[model samples]
Structures are given as C-alpha cells and as structure tokens.
Target: MIRFFTTIGGFLLGSLLITLLLIFALNPSFLAKQVLSYGAKSFGVPSTNKVDKFLDQTIIDGAIDSPLALTYLGLDSLNFLTGHKSKLGDYSLEKSESDYEENLKQLNYLSRFNQNDMPEGNYNLQIKRFSLDNDIRGYESFRYHSSPVTQFFGAHLSLVEFLTDQHKVNNERDIQFYFDRINEVPRVIDEIIGFLDKRAESGIYSPEFVYIKAMGQIDTLSTGRIEEHPLYETLEKKIDEINLSKNKRENYLGDTKDLIREVFIPAYRRLFNTLESQSKNAREMVGVWGLPNGNDYYKHRLRIYTTTDYSADEIHNIGLKMVSEIQNEIRSILESEGYDISRPLPELYEVLNSEERFYYEDSDEGREQILADYTKIQNEAMKKMPDYFNELPKSEVIVKRVPVYSEQSAAGGYYQSPALDGSRPGVFYANLYDIRATKKFGMPALSFHEAIPGHHFQNALNIENSTQTLWKKFGYGTSAYGEGWALYAERLAIEIGLVEDPYELIGSLQSELFRAVRLVIDTGMHSKEWTRERAIDYMIKNVGSEESEAISEVERYIVWPGQACAYMIGRIKIMELREKARNELGDDFDIKDFHSAVLMNGSLPLTVLESVIEDYIAESKT
Candidate 1:
C-alpha cells in the first residue's frame, strides 16, 4: 500500500496490474465499450486463452491489494471500487515478504503456460516476463536495503504529500472516507517501524544525517498543534467547502482534531522515536557499499533504474565524458557573449546566479511569481505540441508550489500524475522553500522537464491511450525510460527554438551537465567509496552547481543509489535511438512517428524500448 507506485510494485506486484478486472463481471457491455475504445480491442477484454487469463489475474491481484493506488486512480469515484476508499490496506514487512513469496509462485505458474497453444496472446509477453522476473530478483536480493523510509521518499513525507494533495472530499460520505483514512495512520507507521527493525537486524540502517533529517520532519509534523497541521488545515478547508450545515462542519472539524491529536500526532512521535534509535546504529558511510552485500545491491539498482546491464565503471566513464563535453558547450556560449572564460567554473556560475534579473526577491510575492511564470511557460509550450506530437492528451497540466512543510528535503521540482477520473489535472510541483534557489534562467528547462512534453505529456498520454490495458496506462515502471524522456524534452526545447534567451540556453546545458556529473559522482560515492563531501565537491567544481544544490543532489544519491544516473543515461539512449531512426529511415523517418514509437508504449525498459523503435523502423521501411 505504501510503495504502491515504485519499480518494486512494477515487477513483484506485476507491472501489468489493472484494477478494471471487475469490468467484465459487472458489465459486459461496458467492457466491450472499453475494449473497442481504441479499435485494437484486445487489451481491455479478458482473454479466453488461459495463459493470457493467468497474466491478467496476477496483475489484477496486485492492484486489488493496493487501496492507496486505487484511490489515486479515482476508483473511489466508481461504486464498485469505493470499498477501497475506507482502507489503507497492509503496509508491513510481513505483507511485502508474503507478496514476494506469492510472486515467486506466480512466476512459476507463468512458466507452466508458456508452451500452451493459442491463436492470440500478449504481444509484449517477453517484456512482461522480464519485468516480473527482475522484480523477483530485486525483492530476493535487496529488500533489506530498500527501506520504506528515505529522506527522498517515505511514509514520513508521503503520508502528508498524498493526503493533502491526492485525497479529496466533496460530500459527507467523502468526508467520512477521509476520516477513515486518518484513523489508519497509526497502523501504517507501526508497520513501517516493524520493517525498519528487520532491516536493522541485518545491519542495514539509515545514515545519521538521514535519520536526523527524518526526525526533524516528523517533529515538525507532529508538533501537537492540530489547528496548524496540514492534515487538519486541509480537511477543515474541505469541510467548509462542502455544502454542509454549520453544526455538521463543526462536528467534522472537531472529529478531525481529535484524530490528529489522538491518532496521528502520537503515531508520528513513535515514528520519530524509531528513527532516533536507528541513527545510533547508523553506518558512517554515505554509500550503500558500506552495508551487507552492498556491492551487489548497487549493481541491482543500476540494472533496474537504467534498464540496462551498465557496470558502475562504464556509467562512471560515460558521466566523465559527457560532463567535459557539455562544459565546453556551455563555455562556448558564455564566451561568445563576452564573459571571461578564465574564471573558475563555479565562479562563472556564481556570477550568473548573482545577476539581479535572474532571481526574484526573497519574499512571498516572489514565490507566487515563480508559480505564475512556470504556468505561463507550460501554457506556451502547449502551442508547439500539436506540431511535434500526433496525439496530444486532453488532460491539462497545472503548476503549484511544493507544500510548505515538506519542501526542505524535497527535490527542486517534480510532477504528479492526474487523478484517473479527471477530478485532478496533472501538477508540476516546484519546490519554493527558498525563493532564491529558483533562478529565472533555469525556469524554462525545469518547466519542460517536469511539466509540458516531459512527465505531464508522457503520463497524461498514458492515461488517455485508449489502446493500452489498465496496467500499461497506470504503473508500468522503469525510471530511465521516463526520466530519460523528460531529460530529452529539455534539449528538445533548445532544438525546436523554445529557449528564447542566451541565459536560458545556458540553463538547459547546465541542467544536462548536472545529470552527467551525477553519473560520475553517484558511482564515485557508491562504487569507488568516495565520501559524501568528495561527491559534493565534484558536483560543484564540474557542473558549476550551487553549493546548496550540490549538497542536496549528493545526499539524494546517497539514499537513492542509481537513480541520479538514470536522467543522463536515459537521455543518451533516447537521443541515440532518434539518430539511429533518422539515419536508417532517411527521408522515410518522420519525427512524429519516432515520438509515437518511443512514448505510445508507456514507460518501458530501455532494452524493450529499443526493440519497439526497431520495429517502427522496419514497418516504416516497408
């Protein structure tokens, strides 16, 4: 229930999971409509073939077990799925272990049907099998290292992020569902702590810095000020917005305050205490390499995130090469503009960042302007989508600031997918914790990467794809595929004339340089055993990164190994594929068709994505 959206959820839980399993049982006509929605008419229909049916069942089972995902999909809007609204499902290590065991059984069952004859079946069966197998391997190998609590993402932050942003209330029944969810926090935190205890038994625990940061976050949240807590504020606001009597509204607010004080605040304190104890046993090293079987764990992470068999050494070298090349490109741009090239790289960056025009005032008004400018940038980008994409999503993307309380450790920017029922538009969350950290030059690249033609574009298209099954349209996992596409989107803007200023062009290249430097620094810290300070220094010197930004990025790589490598590695593969397509197809290759080949399949393993593009080339040649 907690990790219902990660790569683990993709494989062990079956990336093919689609909660629409009940469609055929409840309404055949409706099922037919869904199946025919996009004309191929195969994915939405449950196959009569036993092999296909078995695959469908595994995916459906995983979805059913995740009430949190169901709610995110707006399943609560459906009469059939609303049962999940009042539950958080199981959020324990015991549950994950059992789920892993069940996946093993499911994998074995799948092999039994491989030789079965059928006229029709899943065309992407090999990819599906590969994904599930990969999931099983990671689950067996790295479960201890893959703690549910990290500074980057964990129950400590996710509970607040999800409840405030994702959970919605419209009526009294919805309000009741909200309260039922509030009452589930204690059990979830206890379950998370139980998992932490098990991980500690294996000598795997958060670094002291991480646990300290987590403890601070928990303390901020669990301050016992019910009136001020985001949970109370959000729900109370919802209660007031709904068409309810004054007495009913007061009763709801009073009940919510009780839940916050009695259930939530206490649960957070328990979580805080657990993390406090873990810090004492925490390892001193920054990398997972310091843990039991840490070397193999890092390898597993690279394979999953990059979706390729790239060794740490190979990735490290790639990073070094790209970093040098990108820095030259940046210098050429700045030097042409008559800036001194003799200064240190960080000094150059310092000058660029110091420009008064590049930053807004460090005030509330400035933060609001950042959000507004981001929206305007995204809106303008939408104008060009029709020329680049044959199929554009109907779902709109919106810009918002990261919630005030949790922005400290949050990434500078990120995207959240829309609610499946169209109740929510996709959101691009810019971290405005420090208004000074967000410079104007970086806005265009960040906007494109996290919003238009980046995450929002790909994700919304996935949701709107009539031909894909519920699984493909929902949560097919692979970080490289998604992050790579977004990274590529940043450069695509420069290619297509979206970067309107010389400084903006520098921002785009600097962003690319940042990702490239990640490859070197991430592998350096995790594989070469570089210290945290060493990695931070490398980023600053190489990428001309702000010290605070460098520190944040380095620490992020510490907790989430292999993820930082995904952006550059992914973008490289995508660019290579585009060139490959263009070279072979000659005049036959259309950019729009190439995009369709890359994106229409939803997030894919780089290997699988290559195969898909190759097929597109072959079809075009005919």
Candidate 2:
C-alpha cells in the first residue's frame, strides 16, 4: 500500500513540473503580464485599468526612488529607505557589461510581445514597451562609457536630493530611519568610488570641468553649516512642525548633526577627492560622439524620444527650414516695430539681451519679480487657452526659483508633474541664476509651455482622469511627447495672440531654433564625431545663445544623447495630425475636441498618438 502511494505522488509531481515548464516556455511575456496583473488587482485596480494604474503606480514608485522627484514634489526630504539602491558603481565594467546584456534580453522579450494582445484602451502598455525598448537600446549604445559625468551616472540628481527632501523626523522611528540611512551614506559613497575606479580602468572618465564643478558642490554640501546645509534646514523644520517630545526632537537633531559631520561629510569629501584625482584624465570634448557605437546610440535615442526614424541629416534640414520661416516672421515683426530689417539676427539677439525692459538685475528682488510676472502670464494664458483646448485641468500652477545649489546646472525652466492625490499644485521651476537670461519676452511662452496649456494641463488631466489606472496616469513619460507638447504649446500661444510683442515672438522663435540646432549638434557630436568646441561654436552661430549657456546645453546633449531631438520631432508630428484633422473635418473640426483626443489617452508613442487622432478625425466627420 505504501509503495503504491509513493509511486502515485511521484507521477503527480512530475506532471506538475511539466505543466509549469510548458507555461514558462510558451509565453514569458504573458507570464510577466499575468504577474503584473495580479499585483495590480491586489491594489484594487482591474486589468482593464492597468495602463492608467501602472502609470500612476510607476510615478509614485519613481518618486519613492528618486530624490529629485521628491524635491519636485515639494517634499522636504526623500524617503530613501523605501527605495532600492543600485549596487553598480561608476567603474563597475563587469556590472556595466551585465546591465547591457540584461537590457538586450529585456528588449528582445518586449519585441516578441504582441501589442494586439493588450486591451484596446490600454495604450499605456504600448507606450511602456516603447519606452523600455528605447532605454534598452540607449543602454546598449553607451555601455562602454560608464563614467559618472554621463546622465546615467548623474544618479546624484535623483539619489541624494530625493532622500534628503522627504526625510521626516516626526517620530522616534522616523528619526532612527534618518540616522540609519545617514550612517549608511559612507558605504554608498565607498561603493560609488569602487565603481568609479573600475570605470577608470576601462578608460571611461568625466571631463576636468565636470569634476571641478562637482567638487565645488561637494564642498558646499560638506561644510556642515546648518543654515547652508539644505539637509539640516529640512530636518529642523520638520521637527518644529511635528508633535515630537522636546527631548526626543533635540536628541534626534543632535544625532542627525553628528551623522552629517562624521558620515555624510566624510563620504562627500572622499567623493570629492576621487573626482579631483580623475579630473586630470577627463576630456575637454563633451559628447558621446566619440564613444563606441555612438552613432547607433544617438539614432536609437532619437527613435525612442521622437517615436520616429528620421535621419540626422533630415532633421537638420527641417531645422534650417523652420529657422528660415521663423526669421521671416521675425522680419515681419521687425517691420511692424519700425526696427531695421537689415539688422543681423545675432545683432538683434545682443540688443534683446541688453534691453532693460526685457531683463532684471540678478537679485532676490529680481527673482520675486520674475515669479510675479510668471503668475501674471499664467492668468493671461489661462484666459486664452479656452480658445484652443477644451480639456483644461483643475489643478493650480505655481512658479518658483530653482534651488540655489542646483540652479547653475539646471535648465532655464522645467515643469513638475502634479501630485497623485492633487494635494500639491504643478510647478514650473525657473532657474533664476542669471536674471538677464530670464528675459521678460520669453515669460509668456514659457508660462504657456510649463504651466496652463503645457505640462500642468496635460499632466494634471492624466492624473485626474477617473478612467485611467494609477500607472497609466503617472507612469514614466516620453521626453519627446512631454517636451514636444511644451514646445508645441509655445506655438499654440502665438496662434491665440499671447505673443503680442515682436520681441516675445522673437523669443519664441529663438526657443524653437534652439531645439532645431540640438538635432544638428546632438547628432554631429555623437555620430559625426564633432568635437565639443565644434558643437558649441555651431550653436552660438545659429541659435544665438550665450556661449556659457550654449556650452551647458551641449554638455546636456552629450550626456543625454538624442533626447534633445524630441521637441521638434514630437511637435512636427502633433502639428501634422492637427493639420490632417483640420483638412478632413474642415469647419466641423473643434480645436477643443482635437486637444481632448490627443490628451485624453495620456502620453503615447507618436505613432499610436497619430492613429488616435486619425480615428477622432473620422469620428468627428460623422
């Protein structure tokens, strides 16, 4: 009897193993999707709502992981304990190789998945797959240059700041968590150093200028002055706000100070030393154009961001054509304003730069004035948006100066996505490092792009749409779609009469020209092997931006290849669809309804977005 029972059990176990193997072999993507579905269902989100919910959850998850995300969310300090830390360091050639392999595998798996198997309404999945594929290709291209200077290694942006921002010291447990993490920072730095050393051996390194700037930041961070230390200020403020016992609060604060001085400061100092040592070997040329497979990498970046495969030469030609068209418009504006048509574009740029009405002296007062001006622009833009777009977001928008420490490397402006719960407003962070750079004429278009009809409108609507899953609403966004939309918004403002001043219109043209030049410079450096100086010189001549600003922009492109191409590529696609809709529907076309269709699905691959618009145009005609 015992022998018979054992034989039966063995047979059942063998049958179960075969079935499991068959399921895994049949469809790994299906299995993964099933796991994801199970996880989503556990959160009370149905499979149908997977796209939206996935977006929201991913956004929240990213926030949980990224310090920069926390800062953007207005959180005081990041909760790093909740996020996973990367084991790979700057020099981990082995890890880099492994990462590349893993990326390729993931990409292959995604490419094999049938998009048709996804629910029709679940556009987010398709978008996600496209995004993932883009990342994999990007990783594969730049796997050789595993240096910290690159955006991939610029992990500092999301890592340190995110943790320090949302760190709450309200309770004993919270204080302990802060201390515990603070204590571990040295280990993290050590890991980073080890990674960097590995990278150095592989001949991948940052430029001297980058290290010098990075060291200066480290010095500022490690000086241990409470007033200057953003981390200390955050902790003290949190303690003051909460109902913690005085003794416990004092103890926590003391411990925190000790940790900062001993662990955090030391770690930063070590990192600074490592950077200083490596600075000597750093290259003067800034771009991935010199890296292995640089051309292929850049092409992949362009495809991922723009969701198209237009060649660099084609993009460059388009930029030149657009620049000519915009120049003609500027000439009309100049003629209208009684300015000389013969004045050179560069001369005009210089004149515009020096105009007192267009600039404010660099000061705190000037920063406040800019913010106030931004608010005024927002209100005016809001009044005009109803003419163009029907789906206006209910969320409020605010403009603030970029944090003092980060402002130097930051862009002229950036948009922060609205919170999941709608408790906080969307933000447009303007870098007021140089008040002159923040020209008044650019304010109107900037407001429209960063707030109102731009990021704030699109992002808030994504979050607020009841039909979308959390993932679909707040998941990772395509840089092309997001930046392209913002760029497109600038043009839309002009159409609605927001850029009344010729100089303002000039500013708009300059902005568009800047993006166009990016295609040439980005591809030139990464693919054509143009030196950093070549890229910068070309930018100064064509874009008419300040040399310093041009250099920073070039460096950004180098570190983040093909990303700059998204604006023009995305804008063109959007415009093409809009024109197509207009032609098909003729007088029946509703601008509001058109915008609703574009934004209602949230951010999507350009191809998917085009199909959506095409369908909407057909529906409207009926």
Candidate 3:
C-alpha cells in the first residue's frame, strides 16, 4: 500500500530545461483541454492557441520525464509525446535522491501561483498546493528506513503483478517493451537490496515475522522451473494471443526464458539471500515504537494516513467504543435471525462460522464462483446508484482474482482505477487464496466497496471528470479520502436498500466492525506496545475473522504503521459532516446532492472535505 516515492535528478543542460517545464507545469486539467480542442479542431468552441500551448508544455514535459506514469495510466496513444520510447522507472537510490531535488524545484515553482487567480471555489488548486506541501514534508523527514519492501507489495511482486494485470502485450512493440522490462528486473532488485542495506546500517530492520512472510513470497517466485515461472508463463500466454509468426513467437519466448533463467532467477536468489541474512538479526518486536526515533516516525505516519491530529490514545478509545456498539448491533441482528444470543458473542460466532452455506467449495470452481458473484453484486448495486448519486461514472469495473503469488499477503480485496482514455477497465482484485476466507455473507459489502459505489465509483468519477486536474484525480489523494468514501459507500448501500437480506446486512456490519477493530489494535500495537499476537487475538475474538486472516492483517499493520487507522477515522469524519449538513439544511437537504458535493470534487483530506461540506450547507440554506 506504500505509494512509490518520486524523485528528480541532474541531467544535461538541455534536458534540465525540459525537465523543469515537465515538473513545474504538469496537470491533468491541461491534458483534458488539449483532448477537447483536438476533438473539435475545426468548428466547435474555438481554441486559444496561446493558453493551450502553455498547458500542453506541462503535459509534454510530464509525459517525457515519467514514462511509467503514462504507462500506468494506459496512455499508449500519447507515446508520441515521449517519442514512443517505452521504458520502466529508475528505482536506484541515486535516481531517488535526484528526484527528491526535482520535487523541491517543482514545489518552489507551484508556490508562485495565487489561489485568487484561479476560478472561484476551485478547490482543485487547494488540493494541488496541499499535495506539494505534503510531498515536501515527507521528503524532509528522511525516514528512509520505513519498510519499502514487504510481503504486501514490494518491488519483488509488483513487477510480476504489473506485467500480469497491467502491462499489455498487444503487438511487437508492446512485446518488445515487455522483454525490455524483463531485463530491468535484476536492476530493480539490486536497487532495493542496496536500500535495504542502507536501512540495516541505520539499525532499521523489519520485524522477524515480516521477513518470514516475505521470504515465503520470494521462494514462491524463485522456486519454480524456468518455463513454469509466472513471469515467463503469463507473458508467454499473452504473446501467443498476438498475431506474430511462429518463428517470431519462438524467438520472443526463448529470449524471455533465457532472461528469466539467467538474470531474473539469479536476482531473486540474491534478494532471498539478502533477506535471509537480514532476518538473522531481525527482532521479534512488532511496532514502530521499537525502532530508532520510532515514536516520532509513527506520529508522522498518523498525519500522512489519517490526515488528522488525533492522538493514539484518542484513536484507541474511539475504536473501543465503536467495537462495543457494533457488537451490540450484531447481537440484536443474530437474535432476530433466530440465533440464541444469551450465550457469549464469541461462542455465538462459532455457529456463524460453521455454516457451510456461507462459503464456497475449496476448489477452482469456488474461485470462479466468487468472482462471478462479485460481478453480480456490483450489477445489483449499480441499479440503485441513481437513487443516492447523481454523478455515476461511465467507465466499467471488472472483478478478478488476486494473482496467486501475492494473494498470500494481499488485502481481502482492492480496486485499481481504469486508464484515463478508458482503454483499460478498472479492476477489483479479490483475494481468493483460501475459500473459507471468502465468506458468502460478506460478498455484497466487499463488492460494493471495491467495485461500484465504492472504489470503482469514486476513482472512475475522478478520472472521468475532466474538470478536476490529474493531480486531484491521480496524484492528490489520501487513504482517508479514498478509503473513507469506500467505507461510507458500504453504509450508503444499506440505506438505499441495496442490502436487504438480514445476512447481507450483518455482513456489512462485520466488515465495518473489522475497520473499527483496526483503529484499536493499530493504536494499541504501535502506540501502546501491544504484541502482534495480542492484536491478532483481539481481531479474531471481536471481528470473528479467521485466525490466518487476522495474522495477515496484523502483519500488514506492522509494516504499514498507521494506515489501518485511516478507514474508520475517515469514515467517521465523513459521516459526522453529513449529519451536520442534514441538520443545518433540514428539509432542503438532498442525500443525492450531499453525495455529489462530497464526491464530485474527487477525494480530499477530512479537513478539506469538512470545508467543502460547510460550503454546500451554506449554499443550500440560501
């Protein structure tokens, strides 16, 4: 879940000029205007060449400097902006340091623009300004020892997932780019190892448990046969689909196998060895509190993740209170569902977990059925979106399984936004690693959160809304805003009658309860020094999550620090603002309009979102 840090470096004088232009001026709004102008080059709204050229300069510069960003955005058609030379990113420490300097230059330039010059109520500028400010703040902190590679999502697996889920191999050029990337894998590994070594020198080491999990991930990638490797297998499958001649296909396949065997496998072996060496000295300590200046580092993490000033004690108390209330609600639901609740809640959960109907068979058919059911839930939820939202996204979202290699450490489910041009559909990857973990009752809330009215809705709307610049759509977002909306979407589904089944309603509450539990356990571990086992035990006891699921969740928080706190914290803040708006606007308040105000500007920090809601309330009163 770590956002890849961006950096700037020294280049030749001519390249520096272009890099400065790219850094100081790039914005998505500018690109939208260009696309609009190009579509109506002749007659419709006349273009202002002077204004257009200025914006185009930013787009061109960004496209050149950050080819990977364009690739991630699925912008192959715009390759001419970068001369169609496809390339991956430079992950070395040297490049990172240079990029940091470049970010400072960009920030310096952005500071010159006065908000007054922009259109009235343009929070987009506010978003960009805040984003640059945050970037600078993080860079200055220099807490590079923070876990960069974890079992969750480090370079080790991201490369594999990127190629399988993202990198398109449509034809010869695309395939060639794929091959070029294969050779770059070793360089990325070495860069990561170098960073890790630097961190170890600073007495920074991930917990022993993390090394154990990550080592398993590395083994999964490096243990298989050359031809059977996921990197080789997935790419080979894609190449077969291409209309290449048999000879060309064989050449590509042979080249890929050789690269995997000679370079990729050996690189992974090196990584495995490095991690194993590091693990010998790894401590059993779980929280950031155990690291050097760890207390201060955790405080910084809280600011970034929750975008709030809530203290660890305050968050811990909030989680405790929310957990109690949710448990009561769940008890009432169970009583209504004909379960005797006189027994302790944990005992009652055993009955719920034992229900075979609530899970699928443990086989390939079960995995396929899970994906199909998620799609069905998304469709059903889409039918109710108009009642609660006036601005639904046009882009489609598909459901897929998390790749086997990463699912062992991945979250239950997550969403990826669609490409800017809509060539690639948004994807919701559900972790079906174990059938028992994918409970049937939780399907609706899970689907709604990761697919429609959740990520798919919030993210696609951001991308589709050309008025909100690329910064707001892509760059300027927080877990609080993005995840908060998704969690809130779960509640919206219930209020709008999308979740009518009593079991489904219970499922939604359980999902929410899990988030609430995070607030407590995350704070207790990081701030209060709760053991990892204690945190896991609390989740299993309270949220009724499987033992293995709870373990994975705890390890995730250990690596991520304060991120688990964001979901509940953000959700609570948004819900509070909604209530305030409803009370102030009274009969004039429209749920649909309130939602539009929150969503249409794309995601924002809780504080900024509160301001936006206040503005909406005042506008409604008048």
Model 3 RMSD vs true structure: 8.0
Give the alpha carbon lDDT tens digit for every residue of 1-622 in model 2. 3343377778787778877678767754344344434544432344344334434544554444444344344433222332222211232445556656755654465565556757654566577777777666556555446455432235444345545543445565665666666666676677677878866776877656667776776776787475557666677787778777888778777877777887788888898888889888887656665555556666776787778888877877787777677667767776788777788777766766767877875778888988998998898888877777767787888887776766676677887776644566788988787666777777777787888788888888876676556565555578777888888888898888888777888788878878878878877876677888998888887767777678778877777777888888888888999999999899998889988888877677788888889789877877
Residue pairs clashing in model 3 are: 7-99, 7-100, 8-98, 8-99, 8-100, 9-98, 28-470
**Cα displacement (Å) at residue 193, model 2:** 3.1
Point out the higher-scoring one by TM-score: 2 or 3: 3
Q: C-alpha displacement of 168 in model 3, angstroms? A: 1.5
Where does candidate 3 stray beyond 4 Å?
1-63, 80-86, 110-119, 124-126
- The C-alpha stretches of model 1 lying farther than 4 A from their native spots are 1-52, 78-82, 113-123
lDDT of 3 by residue, 1-622 (tens): 1122233333355467766567546754344445533642221223233322333344445554665666776666655444233456667888777766866776576666666655555555566566656666666664464766798878888877776667888888888788777777888899999999988887788888788888899998888777778888888889888778999989989998888888788899899999999999897788888887778778878888898988899899999999999999999999999999999888787788999989999989888989999988998888878888878888999998888888988999989889877888999999999778888999999888888889888888877775544334444679998889899999988888888888888899999999999999999999999999899989999988988789889989988989999999999988999999989888999999998888877678888898889989988988
Per-residue error (Å), model 1, residue 28: 18
Pairwise lDDT winner, candidates 2 and 3: 3
Clashes of each: 0, 34, 7
The C-alpha local distance difference test score for the whole of candidate 2 amounts to: 0.70
Poorest 10 consecutive residues of model 2 by lDDT?
Answer: 82-91
